[model samples]
Target: MHKPQGYPDVSAYLIVPDAAAVLDFCAAAFNADRLRVIARDGGGILHAECRIGDSVVMMGEMPDGPDAHLHLYLADAEAAFDRAVAAGAEIVQPMQSQDDGDLRGGVRDTSGTTWWIARQEEA
Candidate 1:
């Protein structure tokens, strides 16, 4: 039998040291619209999803290892970078428009979580 047709992409999850804490920070810094959260017995997040603009950001408790971070695509990376910095986020990488057609930069939030912001050039 063949698998039924379905949405190609459903969701993604991020493992962090503090899911609830990070969720709050993301909401404040990026205006994330939290969708749902499932908390585990040990206070770790079992599952969670948030919406920043049209894109969805999924996060949960970090596994037994190092932390993880990811990048986000925006219309104006420079503007986003500035706002994040003004909000007390540390600059991990300075803003620069790359030859590959992207304005990119990095910032580490107050919780020590790093985030990359970029703007892809229009084709």
Candidate 2:
């Protein structure tokens, strides 16, 4: 087996109630770039790929399975937190400096997916 271009060895797949809205929110909050989208039979999204920085995330509308949560590392944790709040994401945990020398925060999107965002502090 060979690795695909622009994909990491492992990636996250999200199942949300609204994939399109989630994509839009990610664009506004995390500056994610849409790579591809596949529509479902009736009216929802079947699959979609989005890139946030160098990381790629795949997602789709809710299926017969459990939901997913993700922990993300950002280059600018503060800015990302503000952007996410402004984009209507509910703050699950406020940003704070950790003993490990990192800034961390958490937010829940409209679809109820929680994201833990973090960034290492400058030396």
Candidate 3:
């Protein structure tokens, strides 16, 4: 299915070692609105959905695979970057307003998953 522009047209899962903790951190730091959480016997996240603005980001347990990364376009990437750092996120990329009018940066969560957060400014 194709999602409309400015809405998330794609979804990716971050397979973290600690789904619960990551979920909590995302909620607290980025104001993630958790929509669903499904768990199985081993305390792994079977599935989950979170909304940061118009984007829906999903997550699950890594289940012994390569690390995962997620990208997001926020309303204020610089503010979000600062907040994430204060909330214990590792800085992978410094915040800067792009030439194309996007305030962008990258950070690695405590789970080692990198997220590229950005906010589009009017041209």
Best by lDDT: 2
Cα RMSD of predicted structure 2: 1.8
Regions of candidate 3 where Cα sits further than 4 Å from its true position: 1-9
lDDT of 3 by residue, 23-97 (tens): 777886689888788996766778777777767777777645466777777767777888888878898889877
Model 2 Cα displacement at 1 (Å)?
Answer: 7.9
The local distance difference test score of model 1 is 0.73
Off by over 4 Å in 2: 1-3, 63-65
Candidate 1: give the clashing pairs.
Answer: none
Tens digit of per-residue lDDT, candidate 2, span 7-115: 8878789988888988998999899999899999988999998988888888978745465688889988789999999999999999998898889999998888888
The TM-scores of all predictions, comma-separated, are 0.74, 0.90, 0.79
TM-score: the better of candidates 2 and 3: 2
lDDT of each candidate versus the true structure = 0.73, 0.87, 0.77
lDDT of 3: 0.77
TM-score of 3: 0.79
**Number of clashes recorded per candidate:** 0, 0, 0
Q: What digit string (tens of lDDT, one per residue) describes model 1 on residues 59-122? A: 7676543556768887766777887887778899998877988878899876567889888866
Worst lDDT run of 10 residues, candidate 1, spans 1-10
